[model samples]
Target: MDMLHFGGLAVLLALCAMASNMIYNHFYEMVEHHYGWQRTVRMRVVHTLGFEAFFMAIALPLTAWWLSISVVEALLLDVTFSIFFMIYAFCFNWVFDIARHRLAARVVADR
Candidate 1:
């Protein structure tokens, strides 16, 4: 495929991912609140796995259609991406949480 077409598909996929992520996060927060679950490492792992699984379900068909590939091919590609993103998400959130806590503590100490 040409670069133009590939770029368009990439944008479309990104938009879809953003929408799905919003929906998934809303629901995940609800579940956490209901269960009074803390954002521990195990919870982060679960969150990443759930998001990846949910995203793969939504992206599989779109990817296959965009690339003119078989569903199996799309699954393989999505799985590869999912693995990378899972690690990234885990680390990003972990660091973000630490930073947020530190900032909050500083604010409280200033008062």
Candidate 2:
């Protein structure tokens, strides 16, 4: 395989991962909020870790074969995904909380 091909595949995979993470984070927040599970942040973290592992295992192997790379290389790519997910989950939730608070306060002031 050409070096450029690998680089292109890597960039494509990263973009897809980012899009999926955004979707998943929104879903996770909805589920947690609807169920009033804020007290179970630890459970959420654990669930996210398991979710990341499950996805990486399946995706990494297929990516490795498609990209003609080693499994280790694929796992390295996936580890990057895992870290992205972990950080995104925490930071998005934090920012979301702040935004929600501001919205609520504005509503109160308007009324």
Candidate 3:
């Protein structure tokens, strides 16, 4: 495929991944809230593993169809992507929670 075609496909796949991530986090947060669970180290590990595992289910077929690769190839690609996103999701959520806490503190201080 040409560079343009490949680039477009990459962008589409990224968008799909982002959407999936958002949906997964939303529901995960809902469950956490319902259970009153703290974001402890164990919980974070669980969240990271659960999100990545769930995402693999969604990504495998999409990756295979989008790239026209075999299932084995897709699984390999998804595993690589999972490694990246697993770290990424952990850090992103950590930073986001920190920022949210700071913002909330500032708002309370101003009151």
Candidate 4:
């Protein structure tokens, strides 16, 4: 496909992924709150894995259909993205949690 088509597809896929992630995260947070789960390294690992698994389930078939490839081929192609995002997710969440906690603490102190 042409660059324009490819770019549009990329944006569409990204939007879909973002929407799915928001939905997944809402449920995951509810589970964590209900279970009183701390955001430890182990929990973060589980979170990352779960998110990727859910996303892959949605993305793999779409990828295969869009690329006219088999699911296996799409999976192979997605492995790199998965790996990158796994690491990215772990670090991003860790940092974000730290920042969030600090901000919350400051807000409480200012009250």
Which candidate leads the pack in lDDT?
4
Q: Rank the candidates by lDDT, best first.
A: 4, 1, 3, 2
lDDT of residue 19 for candidate 1: 92
Reference-based lDDT, each prediction: 0.87, 0.71, 0.83, 0.90
Residue-level lDDT tens digits of model 1 in 1-111: 799988987898889878988999899999999999998989988998898888878888998999999889988877777788789878987898799999999999999
Model 4 pairs whose backbones collide? none
Q: Give the alpha carbon lDDT tens digit for every residue of 1-111 in model 2.
A: 798987887776677666666666677667868988763467656656755765575568778988788999988866776798777865665676678889999999999
Q: What's the TM-score of each model vs. the native?
A: 0.87, 0.59, 0.85, 0.93
**Any idea what lDDT model 1 has?**
0.87
Q: Model 3: how far is 98 from its true place, Å? A: 1.3
Q: Please give the clash total of every predicted structure, in order.
A: 0, 0, 0, 0
Q: Please give the distance, in angstroms, between residue 31's alpha carbon in candidate 4 and its true position after superposition.
A: 0.4
Which residue pairs collide in model 3, if any?
A: none
Greater lDDT among 2 and 4 belongs to 4
Task: Report the lDDT tens digits of candidate 4 across residue range 55-111.
Answer: 889888988887788999989989998999999988998899899999999999999
Q: Give the poorly placed runs of model 2, Cα more than 4 Å off.
A: 1-3, 26-30, 39-51, 54-58, 70-73
Query: Following a full C-alpha superposition, what root-mean-square deviation does model 4 have from the true structure?
Result: 1.2
Poorest lDDT segment (10 consecutive residues) of candidate 3: 54-63
Local lDDT at 41 for model 1? 88
